[model samples]
Target: METAEFPAATSATDGWEPTLAAALLGAERAPPAPPGPLADLVAEADPGAALLARLAAEGALHRAGTGLGPEALAPTEPRDAFGPECPPAAATRLYGLLSEGYSARGRVEEWFALAAASGVRPPAWLFQALMLHRDSLPATAPAVVGAELDWLARACGEAPAREAAADGAEAADWAEGSVAERRAAFAAFRARDPEGARAALEPVFRKEKADIREALVHALATGLSPADEPFLEACLDDRAGGVRLAAQHLLPNLAGSRYAARMAARARAALTIESKRRLLGGTTHSLVVTLPEESPELARDGVEVNTWERRGGGARASLLRSILGRAPLEAFAEHPPRLWIELALRSEWADPVFHGLFSAAKRTLDPAWSEAMADITAEAYEGKVTGVRRTNEVLGMWAEALDLLPDAAWEARVGALIRARKIEVVLAVLAQGPEHFSEPFTATLLDWLAFVTRGSDALRRDLAKPWVIARLGDRLFPSEDAAAAAAAILARLPEEDTDRLRTQLTGLTGVLDLRAAIRRDFRSETTTGGMAQG
Candidate 1:
């Protein structure tokens, strides 16, 4: 073979392929037309030179990718498979999930679970593309793609090489790789040894530009702890606002960090809970809100004060709440979380005050505070609380907190909303996501759906019903059961109303039907429990 220089030529990274036979045969036997971008540049060239140019074009085809991209360093034969590709129906659905039905991203997981249960693999035509895009799929995707993927996995350089690279070798990639690569390497280092990652990062840390520095600092969150406090506290003084913000996020989760300690002290000093003897007899408690004095120094702790970057709330109020939000839940050791919950409902700064506790509870996973806030938020929604005005914003705060509650608490709060027909509040339980829904959690959801899909007050009237249904599709278990429920509900609707509502609930009923079809089409002899029953 011969080569030529064609630096000006280009190839479509995805669409182009080599015409190897013409290139290898030489200009005597088979003259080749110039290919890809070379078409215009080499069109007038004599055949031999054109073939040589095609050979040179090969160099540009080599690409830079995650070690997961497909390549082959040696001659090899395709592996033998134990079973055929998934059923035609299953393959068609997988293609849809990856393409058109991409909006319902949650269903991707269900697709894989069904594939795994069916003991089938992706068809050959889609195999290479699936291998290339495996990162976007569930971790189980490779296994679902089956043992046939072993050679491709090796071709991508992801065997021992990928494993070995994840260790100390990763730190060196900081200088050699792209920002995505650097972040991945730094994350690997952090995962392996956070302290060591910090040490390795600190020496070279300031050398990069601000945006890159911010991303590298974000990698510290992998195994965050008080050990990261000093480093992150130092980062709060960074010139980039994003760097300071990233540091602020990691610090709150480390309650023992100096940042947390300083914030807790400032919060206690600002809002003291005072107990006074009542003139009649008993004692009463009141929250004395002495807001903090804001200044430029507050920026060192990620609290914006005098700068143009000060938050929406006034400097003093913002400072107080920022401190309260990051403060450890134990900061107010004297008062039970429930006491603050009730006080917050009646307090003049209800949302602002409770928001701090809610933030702290979520960051720390303090179940006590989460449960209490959820109860009050639901009570306020039920119209049982007279003094406080129940607004969507208030409901939003507790809806988010509901996800953090213990399983029993999560069930109780959601069940309460379902019984009261507070569809809005019930739907708001997806602050984090609709993932992790246990059987009981999904059972509560099904009951709510059964109630709201009937009558004129049905979910059909809610503008967001379809969007909510799509988001909840993967969380609802046992598709056959959900499908049965959905079909029964549709059957119960008046003939005229039935078709219209079904059109609106395409997200709910459609997903259930699709899942049931997948289950039936891909049913395997060895299929067992997990999602197989669905």
Candidate 2:
């Protein structure tokens, strides 16, 4: 074996190279000699150990000696830079909020919106941090921070040449890009031109990887229409099982499409409404469903042949229920929604029938059916209906249906859920409902939240506190009475006890105070058309 020779020394500090190399290889293989100024310090020291110390001291000198002079900053157009820097206090608060964690995402969005509306940029020192953690920010963050990000990108020589050219590159990249990028590009294209987006994707639909194809097909959900039906229907026979399932999920949304029409016809044929005379006096309507055997058309429309085998027993009956769920609501046009609810409740396939009607209502955007389903769900949740358990499953199903109702209709239900100590259900309902709660609703909810927090046990209060604070900060805290609300909440704190609950209340108070300051600063900036130094 040959010993490798070092490259020629290129600088005055190169004398230390062999000692460093010898230290790396260990003294057993290569002994080191005292080098330069270290000779006086370690002249009598063991050769190997001396060399290691010398390497450390000399490395420090080398770094200190090689510092480069500052380079000139590239020029940026005045128009390209953001209008003004954020107020110093607001910027400091943003840093504190971000340092906390992702729990602050909603608060950060609020700050970003305020900054963007106030025509101010974040502090320059914070740009790199924000860019590094950009993924933590919401999708809408980019638009809010667009000018600042664009300015930084240009400064770092990472900006695209032109917006139009960037878009073209994006379109081209989508063909060969990763799954997420492809989905994003496909969505963007669909939003602009749904038909064109579908046409562009069809040629390569079969050739793409299975997961990628699934994602790209799923993106059609946004601007879905009859125009995209042919492509979706063809995907039902795709080689990828996930692709077929994705197509199945999306096909139901198109209520008037052929796929829906076929499913509706099947449902109408299977279910017959009949009037039965009671023993005492009144007549009652009942639903009699004749289960249809599995067929090619049924399979193509998303009825699974093996579902019964998988779940064990009642295969044909379950398949019939599935078909009815996906079928168009117009198929039952002759019957009132309440009758359908009653029939589903009376039948053996109650869960499937109930879920199917909810799906149909959501797909059709039928307000009347949505309200009826919400009422049934509420009754089930309250244990007012016999034979129905108020389990998480029931609450979950109710939340799903409740989400589709108008805010005004769901508002009272929210109050009732809170009174019932069903905070999770309330959160789920609000999560799926409109983004902004009305003033009256907010006031009512806040009063209930205060009542719950004051009266409930520690565990229950803890469960509800975060959501209450989050909602207050995200929505209601911006209202004119926010200060009053905060003060009222603070005053409600139990006077005798000081613990985690008090700390939480105090923290919420701080957030409210900070938000009030931010609002004032934002108002000043808006009136003056520049960042206000508050």
Candidate 3:
């Protein structure tokens, strides 16, 4: 009966200290012996057997106090009274010995009767044995198993008793059990009747001293869930901070709820409309204001804004929306882009705001609104502005404006023209520039042309002879001297596009010789590089 068949299962491993203290805990003095006949009967039932029962009992109580409870024994064989191989006659004899010690003077039978009817007494391991060995016991064994669980609910509150049960149960719950099996078992046990479990744990919650409550609560936590939110929430009023904190930690993930909504409402209540308009635009017609006052960290003194303001909002608003708090970007939408931009630069946007901005920007296309978005995107990329996806919107805007410039306007803004057309589009645009390029614009174009021609033979072919001549011809051939200079370059230039660049000094020669034509053609026009041709 005392066989240690499974050493690994029964032996304590390093760091897995048992709840010895709770087990050993008892009233300062021992309880009086069971009334008269029960004590005598226990004394007679093999003194060695009685001692073993007491030892097992003590071990069970210790473990139960630590929040681990024991499993009920099989009814076919009372583990303490008879080993597994005990014959049928021996089982009857063992049952007689157990019944005598438990029910002497009718007290045990009286307790059992009350427990069966009203379900208020403690569980008996002997009853568990009978239930476990149900096939071997009287057909009434189901009633016994049910009664044991009900009794356990009452017993769970008593530290020493609970500790004992916990100890006995720990071996079974953890011994080679799969997580699913353990979860299912605990779920089933707790579900049978939680009111009983609740009552049992209530006493443990209040009375038993030490950190035993930690284990008890953990045991109870396994049974707790969304259904238990009301109970856990009520504990928010607990006198014990640890208990309250535990309840609070479990509240968020269990209940599909959060503190964000409450915080957001509070933030919006404090927010003023003037604040929103100042942050965003005043109306659909007005451009976004980018107001300084809209900044969450705007200084009362109207002091000079620092780089912090220039980069993101200042610290005050940031901390409000950080990990510890909730800062919803939708909360700031009343403001226009400019205001939020100004505010964001001051607050530094922080990480959370960056995510919110990402959400908002993807959904809208307001320019000033989106420009502020650029800052957040840049920040998200860790200050690098290289990748296409990150730059897509901004680059797309620059691209659209280029395709619509008029000839006169394109001629006036050379830099703007460079931006509009691909290098291939430049010659076409130049031809439409009033048959003449401005001396300044022409000079800039010449620099660009020189750069391209020298860059590669592939580019030279791309800038075909006919195309280059058409672009520069009108300006160069206005007079005989200019025409001859252009012709001399043409003669030296490669006749075909496929010639080796080094073999055909054509493109380079054409660019160098154009200088004289430039000077000759513009001689009469106030002495600048070139003039408009009629």
Candidate 4:
């Protein structure tokens, strides 16, 4: 099943070792992240399979400890000696953090660092809280998932949102509670009675401040439906710019929104599919483009005439793309994404059209559009296409489309990128991230990286480009096993030529090692020890 594109990874073409390195990638995972204390993990199994064993053992221990009677288990004294419990302040911090959303994810990672620094495992209740408040987990940031709760999300193909402690807040909480309490209350109420929630929110909507209004408006997404579009449309005129932006973003997703209808009108006026008679006697279809003039209506709907300026100057296409991007696919194109791509590629409007549909695909999450957009973006990166700039914005569009693609598609696209040795391209993709990279892909990516890092000229990226070499660790699996494998790079660097690179690599690897060490502490059966002050 492995592709031959990564020969440098499997064969010893560069006079480097490949046996231990083989375990470094393409398995279910890289080996268990073994830090100094658990350094022996490297000796126990191949790098790719060790993490599986670690998780299996942990799962068994978790079940046995939580389910079985205390008398049936091994004495806690031995377990306690090896692992220390997370300290009080850190434990409380984790409890507090669980309720926070993507905004506070950084703090959660810091909590892990502190707990790890203190050589302790996070409290068991923290795991429960994390799973309970799992909504806060970013669909990106795969590395920050410390607790093994991903399975719950994976099983459903989407993370299941467990209601918070305040999911059932009384009317008082919704009507007069603090902003925090109201968020949970409103979201919970919205999920069951969308209309009722709208009615309640609408009456007091004007009274809430700009920030509170913004937050409450975002909560509307929980029960988002076409019926909410009218309210959202009204929000487009709110005094706050952020609220206007939020509403502008949400409206396109509503299948029946007039916003989509208006955008569709603009699209029809701007672009048309015209038929032309060929010289040889056949007929051909052409996508003709004419950008719209700016107006108050366009501005009210959130279109900026200067999208071109912000996007580095493509005035006509930029304006047309704004219209096309906001309109739903059913209204915008008679053809499918692939055919539209064919037409787009032939026209000067390629990048804008492609980007516009990419935006639309993000809103709709249409698999067909996502697939075509992903392929086109990859091909652009591979230089098979032109006009689509090789910018992070384009890569971001690629990543967003990727979030909607199937796992198999993810493997195929990323596998090709790695095979081509598109280092920064791969890094950018991984940096923007997906829900999670499957085990085989994670293994393959890290394995290829490890293979390249050793003294091979084919692995030249680690030697020449700081963006490729230095930042490599940041986008990697935040585990001891992953870092330990990467640590091999340091041994191969020439002391004179790679001093700066060596320093950068050291810092990246150091962070991974610390994360791995923290994971090791968590893996041990925690018993009474010096509580982590973190």
Candidate 5:
């Protein structure tokens, strides 16, 4: 065939294919002839090296001749835009703050709030970084970030258009959107009008995929009402286990709902309290459990009978615990909570009964019962109570109950526990304690820390010291006396132990200093009405 009649390679890169093939197969086996302009370029060059040199020269020429093709038309500006661009100084400060290894990530919300309050939007290039880290931002962030993201989505299509559907036209879009979009739509609908959201989902309930149906059912938890119960009850028999479990979890929160009442009835039937009076002393109570031979009704209510053998008791005990856990706390009104607790503590079914009561206390959030449970837990932790196991599980349950107690009550208990050197109880209290402590409670805690660090080698080595130090940093370092507290802690550090702890103590001091500086800068900026120069 004539050379022109043969197919012309598209570019220098494609033209090198034959030479590369010959080199791989060995030139002696399959020598390649340079084609087209490459033949003239390599005519005087060494044959073995000529092909590669020609390919390189031709590639360079092609690249040099190429120019950026005509630019595509720019995207239209979004009709909706974010507020004013973020202040350049403030943006710089934000970049610096985020780049550092700061332990207090919660402070990012404060920054976002300040930005929003100032009516400033972050730079466009920073939007992707912000989006990736958005979970740390407060829920209110979207009010500020949403418009900016919408602008970004329109310009570059990087983000999903999650703005609430406008008017009625977008409802069709919502139904046809991806799972995340549908969830967002359902949430927005629930917020605006819960009954309407439920109505919208009902028609599509059976038609939705199993996972989607489960998610939609869970959405009922927001703004739940008697109106949602009928639909939820029907969902108890959903083909998906997750959907059924979601229904089971949501029903108990409706204290007076029929589902709760049914659970209460089952619990009462399983166990009865009988009071007995001693001849010379006070009245005592005993529990008489009458487990059902079979309880399909309870099973339908979400009680799972244990198929596996248990050390304490078999399926009967599991059923009792499940029934008691789901039963309304009000169902035990015949006897005071304290009376029931006393009976539960002394009864043969202590573990299951306490488990159920703890569950009930958590669900109801009854202050009195929560306090009583906390005391019971403290007594158990201190080894003052009989038949109460002191495992981590029991301690955890106690801590959970204490979380429901009033802040004042919990703080007081923590102080007393710390003073008594009940390290385990103190740790438990601190683990579940509120983020911010009252001034007096903080002082008491600092005093405990000072005492612990200075007391004994053994005390310093106790695991509680490190736990206290790590957990109390946020609470302590923000106080006005942070520097003084840090000094006190440093002074108490044993001279012999100081070497091992210097790094940790230095970090703590550095954090305190940084927080102090941040506070001062924030105040200065607020007063001056000007951004702090980075």
Candidate 6:
């Protein structure tokens, strides 16, 4: 066995293998063939010419059992392609041929051995082509990919290395692909063996600055589960807020996610509405004052209220602090009216708000309070009408609030329409949309429609009406009033159509089980428990 060394025929500072491969393949040449057999082979291998043929043969052989990898093609006993010393041109030709031949035989171990012997650290472009041209490697080919990775890691030569490996085998392909695809790959790799990938990524995660760390963490998040929590927790205080936020976002989804639970507890206890009224500079009258949770109801419609009104200095704050101080949702439910609910919803405080609302609402089944709580949602959607940020914030609040309401109240109407049964009430209120067609108002309607369409079984009942059923199918039922309204309009329908409507509407009557509804309306509203049971 002779030692093989790649000679410096071309500048080795940067871009060697790929640049040479491109030129050797006659990428720039016209239709006519090059001078000899080598030229003919190069032309044939060119993407403009024979690349497709090679791919086809390789693909078929792969399906036929002659593909690459330990499973498809056995690794060849190691052999150096460039014996003694090889010129760059010879080395390039050898690598090209080796790539093609190995692909044909479904062998990459030979490619690995040759790459290792020549110390040929190909540029990303060349490496990508080399890998792509030899596309027989499995996703598990990271082992082979890593062989190249190791060379680049060691080569950290004078010039900057090609930024990323062609197939993105070096780092997770988080940046290059669609979110769903990248997410799946990242998650699968992490799931296969977390300790290995995470350990491999630790340095890059730590050393990379803010923006890079943010991207890395996002990639990591796709693979995140309880096993990754400890590491994510470590990043909570990362210098980059984005990194911190991404890590924080994943915390809640983890099993026994103590960090989120802890913060939620703290926020529930710490968040408060402090109110204070100061006399307008020169005027005798005072301005109304209210803090985070101090519902306008507490402040008195006409009068001002503030922290000074608290029995103990910051009573409002203390109230919030006390609320946050406890946990298990049950503790918060005992006093669900606390300002924290509104504040948490307003700011979209994910952990604290979710824990607080879920616990409180689950423990108590009353629907009127949920009805009034619904008002806050309307207010939220109304207040934050303009920007995308505000829209998200409002939507977030509405969703959590919808979750907290008694299942019945989640679909209940406010004011006069509340008297109607669930579907009727929802449709009646939805019908009011035309009377209140402002952008924010329209947003609230669409949002509610979407929620009712996609929410839990109890919530979905609102879409059961005949009109809605006709439009959205059995899954998205229409409201009763819509059905009634449709009936009233279509009552004059020819006997066949009316009979059809009657049959469709009558068939769904048994599906209306009021016992399943979880009414989550406001306490300020009627006390009739009709919706909750419905």
Which candidate number maximizes lDDT? 2
Q: Where is model 6 poorest over a 10-residue stretch in terms of lDDT? A: 514-523
Error of 1 at 219 (Å): 1.5
- Reference-based lDDT, each prediction: 0.68, 0.71, 0.40, 0.63, 0.68, 0.42
Off by over 4 Å in 5: 1-93, 100-104, 113-136, 140-174, 292-294, 306-313, 382-397, 464-468, 475-477, 498-512, 525-534
Task: Report model 3's TM-score to 2 decimal places.
Answer: 0.24
Q: lDDT by residue for model 5 over 148-170, one digit each (tens)?
A: 66666657655444553354324
Colliding residue pairs in candidate 2: none
TM-scores vs. true structure, each candidate: 0.73, 0.69, 0.24, 0.59, 0.71, 0.31
Candidate 5, pairs of clashing residues: none
Given candidate 5, what's the lDDT at residue 90?
Answer: 54
Ranking by TM-score: 1, 5, 2, 4, 6, 3
The sequence of per-residue lDDT tens digits that candidate 6 reaches over residues 74-174 is 34334323222323333354355456665333223433344444444333434545444434443433443445543444443312123444334445564
lDDT of 2 by residue, 1-534 (tens): 346565543334344566577676766565444333444455536666666666775566555654321122225656455467766777777777788788777778778878766677777788777766666876556666665666666776675324544666455556767888788877878888888888889887888899999999899997988888889989999888888889999998886888888888888888878988999999878778777887877777678867446577777767776887789888988888877876776577776677667767877778788888888877877787666778877777788888887777777777677777766677667656656667777677667656756764764465444454544455554554665676687787777644555665666566666666666655445475665433
Model 6 has an lDDT value of: 0.42
- Model 3 per-residue lDDT tens digits across residues 385-417: 322233433333222222223434545554554
Scanning candidate 2 in windows of ten residues, the lowest lDDT window is 66-75
All-Cα superposition RMSD per candidate: 10.9, 11.0, 34.1, 23.4, 10.9, 22.7
Q: Identify the runs in model 6 with alpha carbons over 4 angstroms from their true place.
A: 1-184, 194-196, 219-223, 255-258, 264-268, 271-424, 428-534
- Across 87-171, the per-residue lDDT of candidate 4 in tens digits comes to 5555665676656666557546655565555566554555567666655554432333332344444443543332223234444
Ranking by lDDT: 2, 5, 1, 4, 6, 3
Q: Candidate 5: what lDDT?
A: 0.68
lDDT of 1 at 371: 75
TM-score of 2: 0.69
Candidate 2's C-alpha runs over 4 A off are 1-76, 79-86, 117-136, 142-144, 160-165, 168-171, 207-212, 276-283, 305-311, 379-399, 415-436, 452-534
| Candidate 3 segments exceeding 4 Å error | 1-200, 215-224, 254-379, 382-534
Model 1 residue runs over 4 Å out of place are: 1-105, 115-129, 132-136, 152-172, 279-281, 305-313, 383-386, 406-408, 420-424, 427-433, 439-444, 457-467, 495-502, 525-534
